[model samples]
Target: MNPQQPIKVLLIDNHPLVLDGLKALLETYSHVEVVGTAGLARAGLEVALRTQPDVVLMDINMPQVNGIDAIELFQQQLPGIRVLMLSMHDSREYISTSVLRGARGYILKDVSTEEIVAAIEAVARGETYFSSGVSDVLMERKPDENATPLTIREQEVLRLLAAGQSNRDIGQALGISAATVETHRKNLKKKLGIATTAGLTRYVIEHGLN
Candidate 1:
C-alpha cells in the first residue's frame, strides 16, 4: 500500500500494555497509520484535534474523563471524525452510552485484531460497526418493545431504579440531582403509562430492564 494514502488512526486507553498491544496489532496493516496514542481523555482530545485522524479507538474507562464523555466532546470539536469505542465492558449501559455519545462503532478489547481493524475501516468509511458479541447492545429498542418511548437518560434511570436503588442513590450513581431523578421517574411513569411505583417495578421486571 502506498504510504501517501494510509488511513490515519488515533488510539486512547489508560493502560500502557493495551496501548502498546493495539499499536503492534494495527501496524501490521500496511494501509493503516497509527498517528498517535494517549492514555488520558484530555490528552486524547488534544491529539485528536491536532492530528485529525480518520478513526479513533477509544477506551470506555479512563482516568480523569471517561470515553463516553470524551466521545461527545470530540464529536463537537472534530465533526466527521469517526469514534470506535474499544473496551473490556460488554454491559448494556456502556454500549448504549457510546451510541448516544455519537460513537460509530463499539468493540470489545478481547476481539481479534482482524475485527478491530475491520471496525476501524468500516467506521472511517461512515459505516456503523459493533463487535459480534456486542451487537445486541446497540440494537434500538422497538417502539412497541416498550409501552412507550423513553429518553436515553430515562432508560438509564429506569435500569438503575429496577436494581432496587433509592432516588438519592440513583442520583449519586448517575451524577445527577435528586430532583432530576424525581423528574425522570415522573417522565418514565407518564411515558410507560404506569400509575404507581409497583406498576413501574412490574414493568421493569417484565422487560428485564435491570
Candidate 2:
C-alpha cells in the first residue's frame, strides 16, 4: 500500500494463455510487478501466502476451487491482500457473490489493460473498483422487499459481522458480551433468511446496512 513501492500482483486463471497474456501485458508497466501466477485457486492461495502480493488478479471459473468461492479463503487467510476478480461472466450473481466474499473489485476479461491496472491500484489502496460495465450490471439489481427489518442493535451486529469481526470482536466494539453477539447473529440470520456469514454479508451489502 506504500506509494513508493510497486504493486506486487499475482495472477490466477485456468487458461495458460490468459495468464501468459496478462503477465506479459502487466509487466510492461513499471509500477506493477508480476510476483507469481497459478492455474488454480488453491495454488494461487499458496503463492499468495508466500509472495504476499499487494493485489490478486483472479478468474472466477477454475477446477476444484472457483474464484468466487476462493475469495473467502483469501479474506480469512490473507486479509491484507486485495482480490480483484477477472472474469468473462458479467452475471449479477457472480458480482454480488464476489463482493460478499470480500473481493475488492470485479473486472471483465475484455477490458483494456489500463483499466485492469487501475483496478489493481485502486484495490491495493483499500478502495473498491468495478469496471463500468460491471457497475452498470450491479446497479440494475433491486433489494428484496419482503425481508424482515432489523432492529438498531441487530443492524450494529450485522455490520460488524459483515466487516469480518468475530463474535468477541463485535462484542468488544459494541460494548456487549460475546454471548449477546452470538444471539444477535442468530437473530440476524433468521430475520434475513440467510444461513451463512457470506449470505448475511451479501444482505448487508445489498441493503446498504454496512
Candidate 3:
C-alpha cells in the first residue's frame, strides 16, 4: 500500500447505469482503478472479498440489504477496506447512522465530479470526507450531542404548518413576509427531508412537536 500507488476500488449500486457512470468517471483518474462492481449487496461483498479493493463506493439505498446495514458484512469479509457512501440522502439521521455503521465518508449524488474524486481519494487514504451540505448537517450541534437541531425559524414554520396554517397565515404569525416564509419552508423541507405538508405533519406528530 504505497501512498503513491493508484487506489483499487469497488462500486456497489443497484442501477446498471449508475455503475457504468461511476466506472467511467473513476477510470479517468490514473490513481483510481475500478477493480469490481456489483448491483447487489451480497454480490458486492463477494466481489469485494475477492478483489480486495482499497475503497468501496457504496450506494445507501438498494433494493434489499441496504448499504448502512451491509457495512458490517463488508467489514467481516474485508476488515480494512474503507467505505464511502454515495447517497442522495443528506438528512442527519442517515448521515449519522452511516457513520455509526462504519462509513468512512458520505457524499451526495449531486456533488460535482471533482468532489466525487476528492471524496474517494480521501476516504481511500483513511481520511474522512463529507460533501459541503452533508458537513453542514453533521456539524450542526444537536441539543445533547445526538438530537437533530432544526433552526428556530424552521421549527416555528413547521409547528404552524402542522397546525394547518397556510403559508400566508404562518408568515403573518411569525412577523415575516410570505416570501421569507416560503424560503424557510423550502429550507426546512430540505433539512428534514420531508417534501409535502402531509409528510411534514406526520413528522411533527411523530416527533411529538404537534
- Cα lDDT computed for each candidate against the true fold: 0.79, 0.86, 0.81
Model 2, residue 154: C-alpha shift (Å): 6.9
Best by TM-score: 2
TM-score of each: 0.66, 0.74, 0.66
lDDT of candidate 1 vs native?
0.79
Ranking by lDDT: 2, 3, 1
Backbone clash tally (model 2): 0
- Misplaced by over 4 Å in model 1 are 1-4, 139-210
Comparison by lDDT, 1 against 2, better one: 2
lDDT for each residue of candidate 3 in 16-69, tens digit (9 for 90 to 100): 999999999989989998999999999999998888898899998997899988
Model 1 lDDT-worst window of ten: 137-146
lDDT of 3: 0.81
Deviation from native of the Cα of residue 143 in model 1, angstroms: 6.2
Q: What is the C-alpha lDDT profile of model 1 across 95-188, one tens digit per residue? A: 7657655677789988899999889888777777788778755444322445656767887898776544679998999999999999998888
The residue ranges of model 2 lying beyond 4 angstroms of the native Cα positions read 140-155, 161-210
TM-score of 3: 0.66
Q: Rank the candidates by TM-score, best first.
A: 2, 3, 1
lDDT minimum window of 10 residues, candidate 2:
136-145
